[model samples]
Target chain A: MDAYEDLQQATLHDIPRSECLQLLGVARVGRIVFADDEGPVALPVNFRMDGESVLFRVSPASEMCLRLNEAKVSFQVDRLDDFHQTGWSVLVRGTSSYVESEDLPVLRSTRPLPWARGFRPVYVRVQPTQISGRRLVDD
Target chain B: MDAYEDLQQATLHDIPRSECLQLLGVARVGRIVFADDEGPVALPVNFRMDGESVLFRVSPASEMCLRLNEAKVSFQVDRLDDFHQTGWSVLVRGTSSYVESEDLPVLRSTRPLPWARGFRPVYVRVQPTQISGRRLVDD
Candidate 1:
């Protein structure tokens, strides 16, 4: 309704797959979304990008462990700055499964050391079938 | 594995409703989880706390506009510090509906001025039917 709002164009533009993966590699945290009995649930997890998959650990009995296998899941990461009100978000839709015990040792050096304390022994990997991202910027 | 890891108990504790709402009020950004044709999606939105509900604006043709209203949705806000490896997360499960035209004026004073440009005229309000939160701390 005002001149400033009228003149400002905050355009939303798509970022390519290569760039989306780059952003995912750099982000330290992301939210994993999966279905629950009630509906959808989104929970924060420190994640690491390995090849084309995202890897994270959860408690053995956590909902993530119970529900996030062979299930359609989405993982999202973003950088939002309150001062500038500008940010980029990347969303990945994928199939997730628990990492077998045999593959666990290889991820020992992954960057995202779990921030949550306790025995988070179950490792989950999400192999994205589709990745898309968008950025909001002043034009 | 180490004494330090054993001694540093990362405790998980519940956050009360009053405090959960307080955290919701102070945080400027949160993720909304909803179901889509493919599966579930988690997208970040700059939001404001309105009494027991959260309000945000989106474009008319955006996926949020199509899938958000009259749907079971979850909104999450959190603070994570990697250095300390400690954070608090609040999750709100609720039903969202587009703000009626008659009620628009009252929400005009809310804190988050949508950063994305053009006219984001579709305003959404999510009224929480269930609110739960957890805090991770080093004890």
Candidate 2:
């Protein structure tokens, strides 16, 4: 809904929440952005959607696990075609916490397998406060 | 250099600064992360390396243009091969500022053309305080 709306070449559309969740369900990798002491950092992780929450695993001793608990973070997933100059991006803003022991069993059934090889024993779930997405397409 | 270093299946190698810059040079798109009043935000941008600085353009009225000036931000670029489970990611942490009027002509020479169609007149440059990258490779 910015100045680009009137452009003749392309249009940016606000994607509906249901479609955003659908896209999130199909995407496996996304970048999670969070603030560290130094500044904000974005790291790509393999993730899955559990209802509306984003679930991903990390090494227990890594900085991500150390700083992400109870923190406000943003998770972004997108698919872009450089040749066609078209893409859609979904952003999820939420509070991140370690998955509870009681829910681990059920969560494990739909767990995301981290692409990197490691002992990713820590299961972090981001429960969203807001979810939105945008897509740019040729007019 | 975490627990994954000893893993037999895959290895995460710290990419040197020189190579990180090289990778950034070739990549046309990346995610820029910064703090908003709500929390951290990540958005994809078309960017290019100018010396060691990362430069990209945004609409003058966009939220990114409003908040990015003189801000501490993180820009990340990566290429992932899902089938092979190998990829490299480069992260640049820096302070952002508007490109000076006098430098616009020179900057415009190598300016990155944003794939999303719009009139992007504001050029922001991120001067890195630190640049680091990692590559996940098979053993």
Candidate 3:
């Protein structure tokens, strides 16, 4: 190991956009934040990448769905592995729209969810206008 | 399983406060969000539990630390294990403050970070007034 690596502190510059997408891809879980009349609310969600957009399912009963139509929302995915002491994060900002049932063919291409399936997932799409990522590397 | 657990989907309120802390304890990772002049910003952090509180280190330079002092900051801890298809999350809304140097002895009992060995972590204490949690169960 190099002396710099032993230092264990490195700040990332601009990472490639694809790497950012891939990091978001691997992260099936993230938080979705939105504003309500009362205040801001954040909830955990399961998401999969769809070309330039991201797709996820939720229950209408979930207040999350209620916030989707009118409010701007954000999705954030990050990893911090204490074992390796390395971590990176991706933040997505976009407005959301309901995914029509007809689009399931395009949506299922990834088959990303390794977890147990839930109820017919009410879907929402987040199309990113701003995407950014950061990484903490060993020196 | 009990009929209640079987009847409907398991949601956030299904889990108890104590169990939520257990999930937070093992998570070892999460993000903190607070509102400021710009709006809401979420930043990832490495955190640990203190009784009912969640404590983490944030450098003085952190925008999160700057915005959160004495005001309500939301701390989130969650993990996704695809294999088991099960994970739990905890959110705490509390005020954050820098632990005073003189209070080190009291904090030591809570097993605060061994910050001296490596990065001199800035201690951030989040004393929660509102605690909520959620869980994912099979469909």
Highest DockQ: give the candidate number.
1
CA shift of A6, model 1, Å:
3.5
lDDT of 1: 0.83
TM-score of chain A of each: 0.91, 0.90, 0.78
Docking class of 3: incorrect
**In model 3, where do residues sit more than 4 Å from their true spots?**
A1-14, A36-41, A100-107, A110-121, B1-13, B36-39, B103-122
Q: State which candidate, 2 or 3, has the greater lDDT.
A: 2
Worst 10 residues of 1 chain B by lDDT: B1-10
Tens-digit lDDT string for candidate 2 (B28-102) = 888889998988989888788888999888899798899898999999998877667678899999998999757
Compute the lDDT for candidate 3: 0.66
Compose the digit string of candidate 1's lDDT tens values, residues B3-106.
34455456789999999999998888899899998899899888998888998888888877899879999998888766676789899999989987676546
Which candidate number would show the highest lDDT if scored against the true structure? 2
- The candidate, 1 or 2, that scores higher on DockQ is 1
Q: Which stretches of candidate 1 lie over 4 Å from their true place?
A: A1-4, A7-9, A105-107, B1-9, B105-107
Model 1: residue A31 alpha-carbon error in angstroms? 0.9
Supply DockQ values for each candidate: 0.60, 0.42, 0.22
Q: What lDDT tens digits, residue by residue, belong to model 3 across residues B1-139?
A: 1123234333343568878777877766678766655345466776778777777776666565677667666788776665555777777777777777665435454444421124435677788877778777645
Model 2 lDDT per residue over A30-99, tens place: 8889999888989988788989999988898899899889999999999876667678999999999998
